[model samples]
Target: MNKSIVFLMVILWLAQGLYAQTYRKDLPDIAISKDVSLHFISPEPIQYVDISTHAIAGDLPLKNVLRLKIVPDSVTHFALTGSVAGIVTVVGESFIAQYNLRYTEGQAFTVPSQVNILPEHTRPLDVPGIALTSKEMQDFAMRILQQPAESTLRKAKAFGIQAKLNHVYTAGDHIFLDITYYNKSNLSYQIDEQRFKIEDKKITKATNVQSVEITPVWQLYPNTAFKKQYRNIYVLKKATFPGNKVLNIELTEKQISGRVLTLKLKYDDLLKADAF
Candidate 1:
């Protein structure tokens, strides 16, 4: 056999092998109207999920009536509810699946069906979904700032980030971290980005930290302070805080240049969860 022909055959074989190893698949479609619920199982831990909707048979716009209630039963399984009367496409880190929501006139919809997706050779990608809007963040901050300071769990000042952990509570499987940020600096400072991470000293290796949903005020005037909150949910794997683990929250300033404020959280700090 010719050398070029042999090389060409080897390349073709590799291409076929690569194509055979797939990760994403489509979920079975269903007809739905009013309120409905569905369950889907993922072969691997879903790190990220993207939800989009479309109407197939109904005259009503799905976006106007659509609301999602996604509850994770486990790392790979979840239940969805709400105004799901149309098609929903769920693209996660390791799988791409679709659910068809058919409008069945005025019939009350319940649990439709369960979908199970098998993982393939495709690798998961790092993608972030939408965060809270500016107005929403500002309003939430205002509400927190209005509360009296004496209600806070722990108040401390450090590294230009004078703040207090107002409240910490767990709703269902999600954890909420409510905090207030005070500007102790002489000049005005604006928040560039907020970083939340779980720092584990036990393991020297890097941890697969989960994403945080936060609401922060963009700017803080001199001597003025704002409050922000974060929700840590939908984490595929959660870290245990018993082994000297601490939650680090960093607020960076773009106006004041490289200045940053760090707030370190211990396990004890999260223990005091009370109404404020």
Candidate 2:
């Protein structure tokens, strides 16, 4: 063989070997079957999952665990035809994982423990710190509920119903708003809707007022009716608005007695939020 040709062949072989090594470092293949479930356990709660094909079904039985199984119909087809391969992606709070899926005939496989899958990239830290899981945030909110009221000046009343913003707490990347409702009337208060929004501090007939709605990450109370008094905690992502904007917590009542109450908070109120 010519010297130049021999050198070219040697270079090609080396390149192929390097490619194989890189592929070997990829995530382990997950074996799935129709009769058994394959579980992927992570350190953090899984936020999202993507399956390449419909032949595989996936679910989160727990916040940090993902279960995957091959569809029964697909299993029969695979048995008659051949094995099918696809990709599975799992996204967590701090990391992203990708796995090669292999469909086979026997029992499915489960991870013995939490597996440290390679992350595609590191996620940047949010303002204060990493956000807590839903359960953790709920537990913290319950503790806040037990604390004494911190503010009495932020209040609104109408039709013998009073709405007050009692306390504001901050933890991790979230803000907790403690509020209470007092019904002084003999009749019960049936809540029709509760809205949180940021709107212009002042509005005029000629000016176009713009309002932005804010959704709570979680709430401690789900009840809508109260005879005497009720206290609730709402969790929201930590955010800041311009000084000209105000945060409005509005509550409306159902039919017949259509009463409404709103508690407004200025930017300073959010600045006063105590650390949890």
Question: Which one is best on lDDT?
Answer: 2
Per-prediction TM-score, please?
A: 0.37, 0.60
* lDDT by residue (tens digit), candidate 2, 50-164: 9776777889998788887777666544443344446778877656777766666663344232344544423433323346765677788889878887667489898899988
Tens digits of lDDT, candidate 1, 1-276: 999999988976664443231222354445443344434455433433434422222221221122333322211111122223334544443345555443343444354534454344233344443233223334544554566545556566655557676656433233445566666556555567666666663554466644343332232222222433222111111233664676677767676465677667776765554322
Computed on alpha carbons, the lDDT of every model, listed in order, comes to 0.45, 0.76
- Supply every candidate's count of residue pairs whose N, Cα or C atoms clash at under 3 angstroms: 2, 0
Q: What C-alpha root-mean-square deviation, in Å, does candidate 2 show against the real structure?
A: 9.0
Scanning candidate 1 in windows of ten residues, the lowest lDDT window is 72-81
- Superposing all C-alpha atoms, what RMSD in Å does each candidate have to the true structure? 16.7, 9.0
Compared with the true structure, model 2 gives a TM-score of: 0.60
